[model samples]
Target: MTTTAQPQTGRAEGLASRYSTFMSRHASLMPTFAALAILILLFVGAQIYFGNFITPRNLSALLLDNSYLLILAVGMTFVILTGGIDLSVGSVMAFTGILCARLLSEGFPAIVTIPVMIIGGGAVGLMVGVLVQYFEVQPFIASLAGLFLARGLAFVVSLESIKVEDPIVLWFGSTRFRLGEWYISPTGILALLVVAIAAIVLQWTRFGRTIYAVGGSEQSARLMGLHVARTKIIAYVISGVCAGLAGLALTAYSGAGYPLYGVGTELDAIAAVVIGGTLLTGGRGYVLGSLVGVLVYGAIQTVISFMGAEQSWTRIIIGILLLVFIVVQRVIVARSDRRR
Candidate 1:
């Protein structure tokens, strides 16, 4: 017991220190933890109050319902990290969904239609990125134009909801994977998998680091020789692809594509991101935290419904909460600046 530690143990100790440092720097994660706790409590409360809230059937329903939102949030997290915004995400998703439905209506196989939708979305994103990065346009303004354009495309394609009729594709939306004592919908599992992959990409990759660097300070990032323009452009491309896939998820979930499907989804996604502790100014956030934020948001919606509030109350509460978070962020940023 009195023997000194082995040299190999020093490396382990160092690794632990590094991890602790990372965690401490990201102490804002407390909000996510608190959000998780609240959601768990709400789930239990829902079980008591609603009787049907925590059933396996209900669990599956919640997952299926929110899958596309999770997908859209994944892309939004990337865009927000660069201190930029993508208001067009929801509209873009609507556009792509209509495109997929139209293609399937034309007898295009799912295999062919999927890539076509995604590639088309990517092209839209590429053009937006070029406008923002190469042409030096403000992101908000550029993305606003994109939103209008995508909405116009949706209207031009069809002003009404179109049904999807592919039996094979329908299965993806309606199927469930069963295990002993429980089952989960395919859409739910897909959303979870997408979130996990996004977390890894944002947390461990050079590209991820570059995103943070750009968000933290563009001039400093440029001085560090980061490919800022390329990275920024790629971020939107990823966002666009996510939107397209989200459209597919929405279609599969609902069994149809509606021109009005994603109206205000950007606001919901933005609220989730801000609540997740992502700095509005950029450079500080976590993907896992964003997931927690999403769950928290969903829980709030669920809880409000349980409390018998009108649907309109949900929007009011969301707006108030967003304002509170913005004020808190401003104070924290100010204090941090002073300390620096």
Candidate 2:
């Protein structure tokens, strides 16, 4: 028994050593890996516990139901990657949706209304970026000001909910493409497209590389001749545009736009981005990881619904998971520093 235990201990030590070396070399990816692992485990466990959890219809519903959140997550990923926060995204989304609904009700064409909504959101993002970059305002304070401004403007548009009747606006959410039991709505497809485009840009574009460099070290990025100001500003704009798109998706999904529609949604977006393994301090994360994070959030909600539990339980579980991931990130960061 003693001899057998010694061999087992040796193997365990060897495995641990290998893990440490891998982690030291690839510390940035650890959070993403952990998030992916948790997502897989959650899905597999839920599927075993609830026979229908992994069905095609359910899976499709997952994407469809959370499509708006997914869009928000993509934008949030960009902002967070630059080590900045955008608290105004939720409010911007609400403002755009309400504005869109108002315009459509006034007989505006979909083409006209869509651009107005997207550009409107981008404009608000530009404000935040200018405040942060030029005025040297902290991102949190600038975005909070943006949040208030957008929300106030939303109420100014209309305090009451407005129903969306335009065919083009409605079509994205209502139409579903079926592949057997699995179906995806146009909104879901659009969200996926956004993710794909963002991923490509981040991985292959000069702007994306600049974003990473800025997050890693702004001073260094500046010294290296990267356009830190432009990159940061563009990141906020992307986030705002994404929020606008999310608003559009939500409007289509619900067939109505309310000033209160996106309340607390910024928190949800931030949570998903953080859970997706994007560091709060920035410079290390992925667009695909954000997608996985949204899926995990949706999965938890679905599982809770299946169990007939209250919705708050979902928040509790997510909070615990968030705390765990943050600790993991801290450990990885510390280890990397030690290795350096």
Candidate 3:
């Protein structure tokens, strides 16, 4: 009996050691894994409680409803991964949407209007990046200025909602490809494409590697012959372009654009990115994790709606989860430091 008990104890110790070692080696992924687990559990529990919760139609709806937010999260992932923030994204989205609507209303071709909207947003991002990198302004302050500029421009475009009537624009939201009960709209497909491209860029490209290096330590990156300023500026540009795409998605989804659209949405993007396992302090994160984060956020909203609770409850729940993940991140970082 003593010999048998000794072997079991040894096995338990070995398993614990292996887990600890693995965690130390991949500390950055812990939060992402946690977010994914939470998403799964939330889905399973909701399905158990609400008999129709696990249907394919409901799953597709989740992607459809959150496609714009998912696009914004992809860009936010890039900005945040580099230890920077872009407060202007929400306003930029609103600005571009209204701009697109106005252009389409004024007889501008969809082909022309789309590129104008995208370039407009990228221009704003470039301004913010220049302020941060060249003028030595803090990212927060630079982006705040950008936020005001974009919002003011949005209002200047139009105070009232502008309906989008372009065939191409409407096609993105109205058309759905169905597989039995499951379906995906063009907007959803676009969001997925953005995520896939971003994941590949971050995982395989030299610029992507430079982004990580800069986030990890700008000075070290500079010493390593990396182009820190270029990377930072390009990151902001990418974020801005993403914001523009999000605007297009949102406008398509709603069939209208208002100057007031996307208010406080930057916070949502940041929250989703952080909740997905990206450290607020920068340097470690995944584009795929951002997708999971968006799903988790959508799941929470769905659960709250099913409970017949107030919409504000979703914010409360997300806030609590965000805090929990932040604490988890700190612990993981500390453990990694100790290991090093």
Which candidate number has the best lDDT? 3
lDDT of each: 0.81, 0.92, 0.94
Error of 1 at 338 (Å): 2.1
Task: Residues 150-169, candidate 1: write the lDDT tens digits.
Answer: 88998888888889999766
Which sequence of candidate numbers ranks them by lDDT, best first? 3, 2, 1
Cα-based lDDT at residue 110, candidate 3: 93
Best by TM-score: 3
* TM values, all candidates: 0.88, 0.94, 0.97
How does model 1 fare in lDDT?
Answer: 0.81
Tens-place lDDT per residue, model 2, 171-284, is 998998998888999999999999999999999999999999999889999999999999999999999999999989999999998999888889888888888889888888
Task: Give per-residue CA lDDT, model 3, range 1-340, as digits (tens).
Answer: 9999999999999999999888778889999999999999999999999988988988999999999999999998888888999999999999999999999999999999889889999999999999999999999999999999999999999999999999999999999999888999999999999999999999999999999999988999999999999999999999999999999999999999899999999999999999999998889999999999999999999999999999999999999999999999899778767867
Find the number of clashing residue pairs for candidate 3. Answer: 0
Query: Which residue pairs does candidate 1 place in steric collision?
Result: none
| Candidate 2 RMSD computed on C-alpha atoms after optimal superposition onto the true structure | 2.7
Clashes of 1: 0
Q: Number of clashes in every candidate structure?
A: 0, 0, 0
Residue 220 CA displacement from its true place in model 1, Å: 0.6
Better of 1 and 3 by TM-score: 3
